[model samples]
Target: MTAIELRNVSRWYGNVVAVNDVTMTIGPGVTGLLGPNGAGKSTILHMIAGFLQPSRGELVVGSRPSWQNPAIYRRLGLVPERDSVYAFLTGEQFVLATAKLHELADPGAAALRAIAMTDMADAAGRRVATYSKGMRQRIKVAAALVHDPEIILLDEPFNGMDPRQRIHMMELLGKLGAEGRVILFSSHVLEEVERLSGTIQVMVAGRLAASGDFRAIRRLMTSRPHVFLIRSSDDRRLAAALIGRPEVAAVELGPAGLQVRTSDFGAFCAQIAVLARDSGIRLRELLPTDESLESVFGYLIAN
Candidate 1:
């Protein structure tokens, strides 16, 4: 299986650091790079793809150092977030050009195969400039796969895709991962990452905050209280009932409803409905305030 490794790596431009002493291993399967905007996901991917040089430490793809190694391109395929396709070229021509650049034995056949794989065969004759955002994304994937690289790096691959298009691409990535290819894609959307990848690497302000299965990572943060916003028919009575529960850490009465902090997420969720019913309180709304990735990252950073 192909793998990429980074050891105590750091990258900076002038005085600003983009990646800070990150050491992680990316192996065969789909791994999600999860982080907020400007969180160094792209920077890390660029360095791994040999597009940028690390200021310190080492980065390797298989047995070779990625920096200054043009041969890595033979096994590594990067689909950058930027829109860099040639507007004048048709989708087929674009993939064909990439195949030729990779020195494939038969560029025509490879391009055709890639276009078909990405479900872009129908639009292969259309000029790239005329394609929709999602179509442009598919064409980029077709170009990336033309050479059939073992390691695929995608930076926000679902940026412009609608629900249907996104689901299709997700299935495609899952299939690629199942075929024993190392596929890593960066995304800020938690739902996308949760649905696609089994493992995740989270970056926060250039630092690696968490890594591994998200559920496991969440379990590690047991001390980090889960906050909830709850509105009920009788806010005062519900708040009183919730405060008496052993699972609840604290409860505050608010203008909107009851703001609750729970030490045990699972327990709180499981007992909320029962507690409301027993207290004769009708549930109007219940929202987890700290369920977002940003909130989770903040909790991690604070620790």
Candidate 2:
């Protein structure tokens, strides 16, 4: 199976370190490379794609070193974040050119198939310079996919795409993953990563903060308390009752509502409703304020 492995890989430019001793294995199915901008996501992608060499340690794709391996292109496709397409060429010509470069059996047929896959068939004849940002992105995707690669690496693939286009791309990626393709896409958008990928590798300050299922990683952070905001008819009563519970770590009555810090999330959830009912406090609102991917990323970065 096609897989990517980074073992203690480090990349630097003089005094600056871009990727800091990062180590992880990316296997079949979609894996989101999630982090804020300048968190070494693009740097890592470049190294994996063999555009840049790691300063130290090993980086391999499909059990072979990616650096200086032109043969690896046969099984790998890349949709870069930047606009790398020629403005003078029509979408069809661009894709056809990529197919020819890949030395496919039938370049024309491959180009047509790829263009159709990206939903760019209608705009295929139009010059890329005349295309919108979303349309341009689609055309680039078509070109990348012309060779029918086993591994797809996309960097911020959803940038400039409309809601409809985003949905289509997401569905396409999910289908590709289901077919056992190793698809790795980098993005800082938490919602995009959370919605699409079952597995995520989070990067922070050039280091791998967390990996595997995000929810599982959240659960493992026992030191960090889960925060919740609650509003009740009787705020004081609710706060008083919650403070006495073993699950709750702290409770503060604020102007907006009650802020709760609980060590045991599952237990706190189970007891909150019962505690409110017994205290004669009508539950108006209850929200898990820090249960999101944003919160997880924050915690990871903070620590």
| lDDT (0 to 1) per candidate | 0.90, 0.92
lDDT of model 1 at residue 144? 93
lDDT minimum window of 10 residues, candidate 1: 292-301
Candidate 1 lDDT, 99-153, residue by residue in tens: 9999999999999999999999999999999999999999999899999999999
Best by lDDT: 2
Q: For candidate 2, what is the lDDT?
A: 0.92
Best by TM-score: 2
| Stretches of model 2 off by over 4 angstroms after superposition | 230-241, 252-259, 269-286
Query: Which 10 residues in a row give candidate 2 its minimum summed lDDT?
Result: 289-298
